[model samples]
Target chain A: MARARSEERRAEIVRAALEVIAERGYRGASLGAVAERVGLTQQGLLHYFPTKEALLVAVLEERDRWDTSGGRDRERWRLDLMESLVEYNAMRPGIVQTFSALLGESVTEDHPARAFFTERYTQVRENMAEVLRAEFGDELPGGLTPERVAPLLTAVMDGLQYQWLLDPDAVDMGASFRDFLALLREDSKRSA
Target chain B: MARARSEERRAEIVRAALEVIAERGYRGASLGAVAERVGLTQQGLLHYFPTKEALLVAVLEERDRWDTSGGRDRERWRLDLMESLVEYNAMRPGIVQTFSALLGESVTEDHPARAFFTERYTQVRENMAEVLRAEFGDELPGGLTPERVAPLLTAVMDGLQYQWLLDPDAVDMGASFRDFLALLREDSKRSA
Candidate 1:
């Protein structure tokens, strides 16, 4: 029971960090702000996370958990399921804002989150390749292998997020993704 | 002669800020660092750009100018010219990193660069629509209008930048952009 309570508190802290990050961005967010939101002193917060980077990692991991939940399998993801995920993201602006901010910063060579995003993209691209191969055999309709197009798939997903975050009213992220998917489907049809 | 020298100094300062931002990201970059690189005091740098935000805006504008130079017209961007631009970007990792960093932070509601990116994208999308219409007529093979597909074009370009930044060796940004263009060409063929 004590361990369960500790885990619960940790999760609460991660959520608070997400809120602070969404409002102020990762650069502007402070541990004190997150601590105050969760009613903990900075020292007490350190007992749980040990560092801001650790808290950021926790937040990213938790976000992945939310994304892959509901019977979704990352390795076996289909386009339709991915569309649903985009739709789900559209409902959560705060989480998306925090994620976009961190992803942008993570591109810097020395950013603490650099390795995390790099590794994530590597895995994400591989998983995308597997999904593509499962749907379309050795080659896509465009004559490019799944490996060749995986990065583009990941790029489109992320690019849509950036545009949507900047102008939620103007960008329909889910619809835009579906259109890309349609293009893929059309290519497949041509090759078939 | 004095006015010309002042303009030259301003351009020099913008270049310095770009380097600083590329090295440390926008949040970590300081006016003092940029000033030191250009052999100016912080106060001297402020004379050209009244604030850090102004400097950032100038950098962004300079980047756009470089992107659209050489008789290239924004209102009439061809896919081939876009390909050349991507190739040009591949040659300048530093400038790309600074732009990506600012673009990411600009997603925040209160960021100083937010308005600049928002306005820039709005114009970019319109320009992309014109590019598409010039190539394809009123509708694409996918049955979407140029206006509908413009955002995806911009998204793909920006998305490719993020992935390429993370792993330049793995991602051939120019080649991938060309592949997307091929898809567009193929789509047009089928509809024709």
Candidate 2:
């Protein structure tokens, strides 16, 4: 019960932090506003997160966790990954906005999310490459390695999201994603 | 003389504002810091920009002007554009970071920069498309219209810059750009 309760509170704080960050932005967002959103005192909020930066880091980590959850079979992994990206962009637009803003501000060597994003991207690349390697293992197309293609895939998804956020009606993301997949196929064929 | 002096002062304020925003973030960035940077009083700084939001908008506009001017010619446009990107990233990494963070924050309809970004993007797309169309004239590639391709190209560049900033050594931007051009060439040939 205690562990579950703590988990629930942490989740609550994370959600509240997102809302606050979304509403007030990273810099204007305050511990007081976060506490007020959750009906907690400032002290109570700090009990879970010692600083505003810590709270921001937690919010990013939570997002990274939700994003990095790998639950698809190897055969359908690529589709599953792309679909998750589409779904995540649709569902968590606020987090996307907040994170884009954070990426700009958090450039210091020690910024909490700096390592997380770095490691997260690396892990995402490795994991994605693993899935692709598995899918194409013996039948791998072209000489394209997962490592080379993975970052580009990540960049395209991220790039598409930024565009979508700016003008949703402008781009057909589904078509673009399909085009990207087709390119991968072409690359694979060339290598083969 | 008065008008010229005012213009120079405004330019100074915008420059200082970018520096301040880069250092303290958009929300944390204050007029006082901007004023201090320009060796003026906060009241004097307010004389130009009026508010923090205005200052941010002005900084962005200034950056756009600074970045785009005398930077590209019809021939070697691709290389010139890439060099501009690399130069911008190297020279004002912080301001770029701040601007991106601001872009994420300003998406809301009422956010001060929302309309600015929206209008800016529209103009950029149109202008870039026009340039490309003019350059290619009667021989424009396949069904790949400039309207369809310009936005994607811009997004790729922006996304690449973000990745580069996160891990400068990790992303070989120049090579990736060359690869993008090569892909475009292949697509054109296949279409032809």
Candidate 3:
């Protein structure tokens, strides 16, 4: 029972940290503010997360956990499933905003989150390549290998997010993604 | 003579501000730090630009100036020219980093740079549409209008920048952009 309570408390603290970071950005968020949000003294918060950096890592991990839930098979991800993922993201603006903020900051050399995002992209590209290879053998219809196209796939997803976040009403990220997918399908048809 | 010298000093300050902002991100950058980089007191920097927001606007405008110089005709911009622009950007990492950082921050509702980027993208999309119409016609190869494809064009450019900045060794942003262009060309040929 004590262990379960501790786990719940840690999850609650991570949620509060996400809210604070989303509103003020990572650089602007403080441990004190997150502690207040969770009804803990700063010292109590530190007990849960030994430092601000630890709290940040915890928040990022929690976000990944939420995204990869439902035991969705990664190797079977298709265009429709990718669109569904984009739709799912549309429902969670706070999480997306927090992610964008950290991603933007992580480009700098010294950011604590830099290593996390770097590894994440490397993995994301590899996973995307695997999905493409499974769907299309060695070469996609455009004669490009999955390895060649994986970066573009990741680019479109992230790029669409930036535009959508800036002007959500104007940018239909899901539709735009579907359109790109259609282009890929069209290429396959022409080549075949 | 004094007026010319003052203009030169203003330009120099803008350059320094870009460096500081790129290194520290917008939230972490301070006017005092920027001033110190350019050998000015904070008061002296304020004398030139009364506020940090004003300085930020100046930095953004200066970047645009650098990008659009050389009198390359905008209405006549073709795929080849667009590719050239991407190549040019690869040569200037500092400027690209500053622009990316501001763009990421401006996604937040209240950032001072928000209006500038929003307006810039709106104009950019329109310009891209014009370029496509000139190069292709009423319809691109895939049957979508140029207006429909403009945002994706912009998205790919910005997205490639993010990935390239994160891992320059692994990502060739220019080559990836060219590959996207090739896909568009293939679409055109099939439609033809």
- Which number leads on DockQ? 1
Q: RMSD in Å for candidate 1, one decimal?
A: 3.2
| Candidate 1 local lDDT, residue A118 | 82
Estimate, for each residue in A1-192, the C-alpha lDDT of model 1 and write its tens digit: 999999999999998887887677666567889999999999999999987877887898888876666525555377677899899989877777767777888886688887888888888888788888887777664567788778888888888888888888889999998887766676656556
Tell how far residue B118 is off in model 3, in angstroms.
1.2
User: Candidate order by lDDT, highest to lowest?
Assistant: 1, 3, 2
Model 3 per-residue lDDT at A159:
80
Candidate 2, residues A1-192, lDDT tens digits: the string is: 999998899899999888877676555568899899989999998988998778877898887666555545444456556665766565666666666656645553356667766766667677767776665663322334666656666666666666666777776555555455555565444446
Deviation in Å, model 2, residue B80 alpha carbon:
4.9
TM-score of chain B, candidates 1 onward in order: 0.84, 0.77, 0.82
User: What ranges in model 2 sit over 4 Å off?
Assistant: A1-4, A15-39, A71-76, A108-111, A131-145, A171-175, A182-192, B15-30, B70-80, B130-144, B188-192
lDDT of 1 by residue, B77-186 (tens): 78788899999888877778777877888887688888888888888888888888898878764567888788888988998998899888888999998877766776
Candidate 2 structure, TM-score to reference: 0.76
Arrange candidates, best TM-score first. Answer: 1, 3, 2
lDDT of 1 at A155: 86
Among these predictions, the greatest TM-score belongs to: 1
TM-score (all chains, Cα) for each model: 0.87, 0.76, 0.86
Clashing pairs in model 2?
Answer: A141-A188, A142-A188, A142-A190, A142-A191, A142-A192, A143-A191
Clashing pairs in 3: none
